[model samples]
Target: MTTPIQIGLLVFPNMTQLDLTGPLQVFAAVPQFVPDPGAEIHLIWKDLTPVSTDAVMVITPTVTFADCPQLDVICIPGGYGTDALIEDQEVLDFVRRQAEGARYVTSVCTGALVLGAAGLLKGYRAATHWTAMDMLGAFGAIPTHERVVVDRNRVTGGGVTAGIDFALTLVGEMFDHPTAESVQLRLEYDPHPPFNAGSPATAPADVLARYEELIAPNKVRRREAVARAATNLAG
Candidate 1:
């Protein structure tokens, strides 16, 4: 039998741990359904060292981007480092090259920011952390406000929680609805976030404003970084 689909899951410092591991659980649990010994899911990193999240979250790297085998899929996740990692050449390069090689490229939350930085968002209709979608156009992506946006082979999520939806969608794509449904059932994937504050529109006006104020600094930095990436691509 052919080797099972290989997935390259990119992780970085200050990433919302949930963004990476949540979708990870979706994919990792696939083996129980497919039971194909060849299926492999790798937690990739910039280096072999342990990486820390914004909330002091940390996870060891299993493979560096360089050693990342040509993958069937690549998953980029997001968190506090969204802005900073945008300007990181190492992170940008890894995302760019790996995405170029992968059959499909996906992101969760502001993880779309990384794909934007890698110049992969151009012409794609994608979703991201609502507050950050404005920056997507700076990189030429036509941003959409949805939990999951799929344009060609590029799949993006709205925020941290959307990772589960993103992965379930992919499972349906890679295999079939039965495969996805099976995995979803195993995950008890029924979701219900108690607060409506998850989306900009669903939340109260003042709460949205507060969120803007909190992320404003990162916005300035992310905007500049995206502009630079766009400029570099133009040249």
Candidate 2:
């Protein structure tokens, strides 16, 4: 019998729902496209309750931290809630324990900050939301400004929607190019953005400035949180 590939996605309050669900849909479809894919995804949290997301969506976790099965892949998705998670020892401990045995440790957007808080990203090249890319340095990670970054067993995606690209990349890594391509075709994963304002370099200067100003307070909070988390990891 083929052993099942266990995958866990950590969910928390105020997370960006797409960050967790986008990759989930891709991974869930693997069994149909690949023979005996054996991929099983579990939504895990500290408790089994419905967690509210940044948007109007809410998700209930399938398992608790203590009862989660040993995983082949562990993924963390980011959102506004990440600021609080950076200082959460329980969540960090859970991530540390799972990462020790998982084949892949991955993150989307600011979720990398949580991984960093868990001491998982030390010396790894990772990616995160563009706004927080520089913050990876506090956790000893070399931050790369790309949609998806792969360094050894650590794979990370930038921003919210990039989780789709990250998931496809993981599929390619776990299976093959053909399998990933097949999944992409099945999902019609094609990009044709009407505007070229995805990145700071491409965005209109005024638009970018407006967003920066809007998020300034959050950034300050995150910086302080990262500092505290880094200090905790150091000791």
Candidate 3:
């Protein structure tokens, strides 16, 4: 029997729930899907220890980085922890290593920052939270303005809530458009932002300005993290 296609998603502390949870829900529903057990996905991490998210969520990883099974696809998701994970020696080391053995590497939101830190985003066109997209250029990525961007094997999603779009796109690539459509139907993935302020272009100038102001502090920290990681690479 052909070994099943396995997906390993590395979850770190404070990972955005929507990042992994969105993909998890989409992929888990695959079996009831289209006779596609080969497309199974698992949550993984550096250690099987408990990983806390934001403030009130936690889950013990199913496998450690060293013990992880071979993966056809691996994803890293963004959250507050992504800022730290991007600089963590152990976590970045794991991402760098696992990416070597997987066919595809993917991320969401600032998770692209982690991929950039891992040196995997070099020469790739990618996207992230609009508020943070410019930093990808700093990390040597071709900045993009789309909700989802894929270059070569590295796929990235924008902001915290784009996971559904990213995962559906991934599922389409892994299976077929029919499969993706089926999943979308089940998810009612049709989006309807109540305020019309989701993206920079759609939102009022004042709202966009407010977003920039709010995220300015995070960018300061993000730049510091990028600098430290890049310096490490250079040295």
Instruction: Report per-prediction Cα RMSD to one decimal.
Output: 1.6, 0.8, 1.6
Ranking by lDDT: 2, 1, 3
In candidate 3, position 183 carries an lDDT of 91
Off by over 4 Å in 3: none
Instruction: Name the lDDT value of residue 40 in candidate 1.
Output: 90
User: What lDDT does the true structure give each of the candidates?
Assistant: 0.85, 0.94, 0.82
lDDT of 1 by residue, 177-206 (tens): 998898899989887878888778789999
Model 2: lowest-lDDT 10 consecutive positions? 31-40
Using TM-score as the measure, what is the rank order of every candidate, best first? 2, 1, 3
Best by lDDT: 2
lDDT of 2 by residue, 113-164 (tens): 9999999999999999999998999999998988999999999999999999
* Pairwise lDDT winner, candidates 2 and 3: 2
Segments in model 2 whose C-alpha atoms lie over 4 Å from true places: none
Better of 1 and 2 by TM-score: 2
lDDT of 3 by residue, 1-235 (tens): 4566788888888888888888877887676676635566678987778999875879678888888887888888888788788778888888888899888899888899888888889899998887677778767889888888878878888887888888888888888899889999998988877798888888999988987898789788878887887777556
| RMSD from true fold, candidate 3 | 1.6
